[model samples]
Target: MLKTLYKGFILSYLLITISCTTNQNSSDLIQAIDNRQTDKALRIIDQLDNLNEQDSLGLSPMHWAAKRALPQITKALIKKGCNLNITDVHGYTPLNYAIKADNAEIINLMLKNQAVVYKNGLSNLSDGPFVDWTEKGLYAYYLKHDSISSKSFLLGKFINQNTRYFKGWNGDTTTYTITDNKIPAWEFKTQEPIFVLGDIHGQYDRMVKNLQAHGVIDKHLKWSWGKGHLVFVGDIFDRGNKVTEALWLIYKLEQEADKTGGKVHMSFGNHELMVLNKDNRYIANDYKNLCNNLGLEYNTLFHSNSVLGEWLRSKNSMTKINDILFVHGGISQKQIDSGMSTQEINELVRQYLISGSSPKNQDKLNQILKSFGPFWYRGYFMDRSQYKKITEQELISILEALKVSRVVVGHTENDELSALYNGKVIDVNIPLAEDSIPNQALLIKYGKFFRLTEDGNKTLLN
Candidate 1:
């Protein structure tokens, strides 16, 4: 017992000594940074030969540079190959420190240097802060900078499409409005032709190419499908850099589709929900740099006030067209049992999304957010790697409960578009944005399924 106690004491003493030595080495660098002696700091950092080493406070020199908004030092640390995504003791990244300093330039530099943007690591904005900024501060900044008149700036940067502002009241009653959104209902009982595309994942060029090849859109991205309805089965964000370009194209097409009697519907995917809620782990670094440089939070790009953002929020994750149901991730029996009606489920989901808590049925909402929601349920296709896979009988049960013939979904990454459960469940997220696969979509015409390729040809699905 005495020997064991001595050993423990020696180990503790050694750890303390090592920690003290590290702190001593880091102290000079921190002092130089606090004293604003950049040259001395840089010299001390070099002498220490620990560009990425954390101090007693778990803050590296890179963190200090970022907190100070010193772009030059940040760049130097990045060139020295520091761990740009390293989180400090407070769960703050270098990007977060820069954003806290309100140094957009340094934030941009860190983003360019491949700093992390997951959660609130970039903007120090999420939840209450996110809601507050999007509501009051952003437009105030626009007014302060005299940029309310630039329509392109407003739409592209602020995610809004507005030309004028009017505070007039109608007979002393205040009113709010959604402008010029004229899409049809979420669920359509129409027997009309439907073209269903999977996740685009920021692949603008590939999306354009596929749409052109299928004659769905003209070279200018105008709708050419006439009365044929087109649906995107969730996940239009993250993993690639051309998200803004793709979103603008979709926005333009929605208008053209409406004018031509066609329609466009974008369902919500898990990734979409994650980003809207300020979780950006799957986002690309280029997107991070772009948003930071433009002084745009990822939050602002998809708030309730934004055009596409509002439209997305108003959309249902699951929609049934004719007899075929479309969703992002596949559904399960638990989700089917959660609510009595489709409208009920949709309302519950949208409500939970806005408020972050379920008002009435907390149990149902929690299940939906977990393994069996319309946006997250993946049991139909994810059978091998996952602990749980919804059985074939369960899939049929869910479909029967929902009164749908088949469930088409796009969340699981597949090498090829797959039709599982004997044609009851179809997985179509080929990730054209990431894999550069030949553009493919599922076409349902008069209740028959076919794979529509880029050659404008349709192969019958057996």
Candidate 2:
């Protein structure tokens, strides 16, 4: 009895020892792959019994190897009996990671290994990561075959603003088209009434009703506010779906408004910046599938090659109409210290999006991408204690330095339009997704400011 007990205890101890060693080896393997220390990684990987072990995020060694395009490491794992068909928490296989890396060589290698992938580029919201759209499409049928299931979004299936329908996909076409012409803007010196609306947040009905009531759009959703400057101060994507519908409407209005000497502008919002940088948490699935069909990520969909990407990338984080500065998020003193003029800032941002964010301008780019940058500054609205506090004089000084009488911003949501810093800072970010009531817009005629509601009523903010 004593000898039997000793043997069982020794066996249990060996199993625990092996488990601990294997876990450590798996972590070390991942680091070596990421650090390009292939030699050390190979040493550690040889000690592992399980090659398909996932991290807390459900990414295995194979996923990392594929993302890094380490062909040798990938092959070694395959030889060691790693499952190529295993999906991560987001349902992305190694094939998806390879597609994101844009490594055609790795993709071919995976194909050679008989790798299978998810269908339709679809994943349940409750599942893993949203479609990992890099400059390339999602899993399977990418540039492989026509008549793919992903093309369903490209048809006339999408609902647009509850009034119009959009035909997304066409069989055998290089570019898809919407049936309407419209587009997105802001002001000039000493001229038309400048209309600034705050965050749309995919509430199409609220946007249209407010615009139509204010004579911005007719019942048909055409640009009716002729020669008027209309601006969406940012946060037009995410939360509710219909982002594609909202964006298309803005695009169509931009074209129509330009024809009649009017302007439609979308200032850079943080949400837009986030999506442009590839955070797809709030991204609509239909949008993702469409992005897949085009062999592009959500960001690259509006890349320099695509007209929509060009237009969106060309938009400024901050704009000046006469003197009042309009930005999606407020600008800080730090943004000014970057020593970039508004035009220069816009150019820099455009350059960053078109070209990859490289090392040379990385510092400047990092500063701009920070929370305090123009499209993300909350110092002006948040209680100075929590974020950063500014005296009224300090606020005026900041505006004066930029040569603006007042500043208009969206992002800091309030129950209604608000005038802070004695009207020097006008926050137009109303709660669009929450309130059923149609919202108001900030109207500037000459130098005076007023809140214009959807009921044709006006409230003096001065």
Candidate lDDT values, in order: 0.68, 0.70
Error of 2 at 47 (Å): 44
Candidate 2 wrong stretches, greater than 4 Å: 1-187, 284-304, 384-387, 436-438
10 residues in a row with least lDDT, candidate 2? 124-133
Tens-digit lDDT track for model 2 on 416-447? Answer: 78788878999898888887644888888866
Clashes of each: 0, 21
After superposition, candidate 1 runs with Cα above 4 Å error: 1-98, 102-178, 181-184, 292-296, 358-361, 384-387, 434-436
Q: How does each model score on TM-score?
A: 0.63, 0.62
Residue 59 accuracy (lDDT) in model 2 = 85
Model 1: per-residue Cα lDDT over 1-462, one tens digit each? 999999999999999997776668677777677666888777766656567767777787777887787777777777777787787887666666777788766765664444554442232211111111244222211101112321111111122325322222212121122245442366787667888889988887888887888779986567899988889888888887667557656766777787888888887788888888888787777556545534457755567665556666776766878778888887776666665476766676676666777456887677767766778776776654433777888777888888887889998877667688788888888867554566788888877888877767778776
